[model samples]
Target: MRLGYELKEAAKISWVAINSNRLRAALTTLGIVIGVATVSLMGSAIAGLTQTFEDSLSLLGTDVLFVQKFNWATGGGDWREMRNRRDITLRDAKRLERELSMAQAVSVEAQSNGLVSYEERSASSAAIVGANENTAMVRGFLLADGRYFSEADVDGLRPVCILGSSLAENLFPRFSPLGERIKIRGKKYEVIGVLEKLGGFLFGDVDNQVMVPITRFVSDFAYNPDVNISVKAVNTELLDDTRIEVRGIMRKIRRLGPGDKDDFAVNQQDMLMDAFMQTGGTIAAGGLLITGLSLLVGGIGIMNIMFVSVIERTKEIGLRKALGAKRRTILIQFLLEASFICLFGGLLGLGIAYPITLLMQQVFPATLAWPVVLTALLVSIFTGVISGYLPAFRASKLNPVDALRQD
Candidate 1:
């Protein structure tokens, strides 16, 4: 009871001292306040960026794999290597679809650049994608109006099209695009579906393109024989097994000899995620390093202020030591004073940062999670300990006779 009482008395004295020099104490805490706010904001921004990337990539589907002539992330960053590999074609996509039992769905895809026109309005150099009926399922495309292409449309080589959300809006802002005939390179194609808005991807825009039947694309642009194949696993648990089965089926279809190496790449979402994480990590590390320097400066400032406070309170400390006060009491009082200052500053920082985080939600999702808040408080307490220890020790060890002799 006595120890507790002494500790409470010490805290009261420290609080009183802080109130006596309110402006000086507030100025002393400014460094800590700025440091905490900056670090918290940086952490939240990085998390927001990560969330945005994942949401954008969700259009690719987590369980789907892309079989192509080259890997987009790796492969020595050489185009010649990709070019020298055998071209993946629509036929390969068909063969894979027919032979692979592990795959729930497969689609053939190819791209070209063309101008889409609707009477007075036109978008030049628009992305043109060629796909079969399965493309809608494999690529996670949703329609805002009308329906996706049917099997009959693919078989008969119908000049049917689906406009991306932005494309539809640009071409037919005032009216619906369903059943409307649009021209692509002087060739007429009827808009059968207008895809729902998919925002954008870092790799490409998902809402500024058009999809047509594979046959229609082959007829219009025959120069590019390269086709990409997308395969979706039956379920999440079967992804690995499905990849293995796909590799075997693909190897047999390509007629590679027993000794020959595979020329194609089997890509899953993990590959893209891995690449993204590597880049994200470097950026996050750089940002944290800069912010860490700010924290170090703050810690230094706290240490400087605590030393000054000890010097100013030398006589009071001497008077207490001459009485019944122990060395531990003096140490605890100084430590509590420093801790209270930092804790107060940290809470103030959080208050200021809350509004900024809410505003950031407009650009990206910056949530002030409980874990981050708790961590900031814990970090404030730790900073107090590290910065206040030396000063607290010096005050505790002061000789009563020498301290009383000081002015």
Candidate 2:
């Protein structure tokens, strides 16, 4: 009960002290405000990027592996070797399909860019995907409307196409895109399917493309273009085995001898995820260092102001000690005062961060979660304790007679 009374008196004194010099307290906490705001905003940005990347991973297909001529994670030094490497071809995809027993599906995909036009509306430089019937299965593309082009469509080199959601909206805004004929590279093809919306990925927008049969793509666009093969595993459990099988078969298809190095690369969603994690870690480390410096500066400012406050309140400390105040009570009063200042600054910082987080949400998935808020507040209190300790301790240990003699 005595401890509670001391705490109450201490809090009352702290509040009055802060209220007496509102402008000074606000100015003193400016550093903390900036520091906390920057930390919160940076954290939200990293979280947003992580969430966006993870969401896009589903579209990349978890159970699938991509066979390509070059590694997706290759550095600049390896570019020359990759450039000289032979292009992954249709024959390699066919061989994989024929030999790989663990694969559920194999797809040959080629890509180019061209104008897609419907009546007067046209989207320029839209992505053009040359894909087989199994491409949808391997790449995890789902039809939003109508149906995917059949194997017959691929075999006959039929002028049938699938529109991405964004492209369909741009071309046929008012009605369904099904059965509507659109021209690709000046050749007319009927729209057989419209794909569900898939936002931006590492390469570019997935929902701004048109998919046609690989055979048709070869005939319409460049002849015998280099292609990437996508192989979907029979099950996720069989993925590693499937990858090994694919590598061995690809090596055989290329006719590499026992001592020859495998020229091909097998890529997966995990590779992209690993690259993103590394990038995120680097960014987080840098951001933490910058924010830590800001907090350190803020803490120093708080400590400086606290020392000044202790000197200014010397007479008051003497009077309180003379009136039977305990050493702990004096310490608690100054500590509470510093805490209130930082707590106010933390709240203000969050207010500033909230709107910025909202602006970031427009581009990604940034959010000010409760855990972040709680952490910021806890950090504020912790800073207060650290900054106020020296001054509070000195105030607690003052000689009443000596303090009273100070003018």
Find the candidate with the highest TM-score and give its number.
Answer: 2
| Candidate of highest lDDT | 2
lDDT, candidate 1, 102-142, per-residue tens: 88898888988788899999999888889999999988988
Across residues 1-407, which tens digit of lDDT does each residue of candidate 2 receive? 98899889899999999999998899889988987888788778767767777888867877899898878663522767877998888777788889988889999999999899998999999999999989987887888999997999999999999999999999998999899899998999999899997775444467899999999999999687889999999888888999999999999999999998778888888887887778778988798678868877887899999999899989999999999988999999999999988888889988999999999888767878777778877887789889998999999999999999998
Q: List the residue pairs that clash in candidate 2.
A: none
Question: Quick one: RMSD of model 1?
Answer: 2.7
Instruction: lDDT for model 2, please.
Output: 0.87
The reply for model 1, stretches above 4 Å from the true place, is 1-3, 72-83, 120-125, 200-204
After the best TM-score superposition of candidate 2, give how far the Cα of residue 318 lies from its true spot, in angstroms.
2.0
Q: Local error of candidate 2 at 205, Å?
A: 1.6
Clashes per candidate, residues 3 or more apart or on different chains: 0, 0
Candidate 2: C-alpha RMSD to true structure equals 2.1
